[model samples]
Target: MHQPNYIILQCYGYEAVFLECAYALMSLSRLYKPEELTNTEIWVYTDKPEWFDRFADCPLPLHFRKMDAALIKQWRGDIDFVHRIKIELLLDFTETRTGNILYADTDMVFLQKLDDVWNGLAPGELYMHMQEGKISEKGNPLFRKLDTFLRSGKAIKTEGTPLYDLYMWNAGILGFHSSHRELLQKALEYTDSEHPKFPKHIIEQFAFSIQFGSKGNIKSALPYALHYWNMKELRQIIASFLQYFDGKPWADLVRYSSLLQPYILVTEKNMFLQNRSFTEKVLNKKWVPAMPNWELLEKQI
Candidate 1:
């Protein structure tokens, strides 16, 4: 039998936001109806372990960990936060012996069953957030500036380093086999390298792009979940989304603004929930993979 598992990265905070994120995920869990439903293992990595102990008797097998917030504060590299999450996954994967894994962000609600995703895993292949555009695609004005910085000869360098570029990805929900251990190693190398300053989220994304290469090993996924508010283009995308949503049922927003959503999804949980519900509506009753490459206002790196 194919064993399935779920992982989530979280931190304790205001009750409403936590409830919103948990509800969205639990709602998705209810939809999947997995056999291990009574014993489905769910691992949560957080700085606040106490927040999750309340569910000690729940059907979902819950594992919790308290992470050092200082690493995030001091290094703040692109892959730092997620790299830690991946490490948590790596360690848990070794310990739990779960054969298949589905990684999700806490703030998304699943609209359809994920059995297909679980069944689709191929040997040696792992699920990754699809890059929005082609490799050769040049980024927008702000991103161009970021590229300039990378090439400016001022970045921290290490041997075998490759200059990076790639599209954005909203990692709300992704499925992959536990077999792709090499991917995690490669991602860590990319994130740990010296840089003038630590790369934030984009570093891991860029590393993932390079790791997957042109074959697009991590093929695009139909929109399955929505990440809430991201900070990259906090000002513009919000305005554009309001315009894009334009009186449509809030659920239809992602279809219209998928290209811009990833950059804004991680910043605010409440906004993420509100917009995710709206985007879920127009997304072709099935998941719609996000658009890869498009001009977007860049953030300070």
Candidate 2:
């Protein structure tokens, strides 16, 4: 059976970010058996390759690509263009490789078998994290920055496309087949050009939204994975757990940590708070129970 290729990016000197990457890999190891992931290739693009040396014994076969600091600096310029690297890395990966590619952020955790999700991907389709809402030059909080870009002439409006018709999607988890290389290429081109127009934080995601208008075949990956982007408090808790098991083997670390049940619980609670509807909150009053074995997690180390 053929397996899909997975790519993750971690650049510069954020130690917490690096720990997140390790924890993500550990989650992958915990979710799938060895034979299930046997032929799958996992690549990490990073400027600080040595930081990943500690994960040398990772159960999953890992490949490390050292990023060019000068090129990154030139592409990023003065603005905080950290997310732009994701576009560059995706373009680089799709150039030489073929077939299903799954690109994920470091803060995501896999909760179930993704074989069905991988199998469902078809050629000429692009899957994104989640569709936020339609884009707008006014009224919408997210796209007001894009409106500024349009007003400044930094971004060009596509012919026949109204600003409100273009939908914005989160870029945390992206899945595309080799046949849709041009889709990613278009995103890279926009990132290299009108990056200044986008808000420094969501430039890559906004650029992707522009390239992938309503016409783009965008699917959702929310059922298979959990994205903990911007959940700082939960991230700190997970970091503490990773630090406790700093030098342990990946298999042993995952086995002893109860497969990151506590981390998953915390993440779910945070997500529920952010996404729960008013009716759900009122009627579905039952809250997710807190992890009972916090002391056990610490004692295992």
lDDT of each residue in 171-230, candidate 1, tens digit only: 444555666555656755655763225445555555555555533457444455544433
Give the lDDT of residue 293 in candidate 2: 53
| Candidate 2 per-residue C-alpha lDDT over 233-277 given as tens digits, one digit per residue, 9 for 90 to 100 | 445656666666678777777776553654556667767777888
Q: Which residue pairs show backbone clashes in model 2?
A: none
Lowest summed lDDT over 10 consecutive residues: which window, candidate 1?
Answer: 292-301
TM-score of 1: 0.58
TM-scores of all models?
Answer: 0.58, 0.79
Task: Point to the candidate with the largest TM-score.
Answer: 2
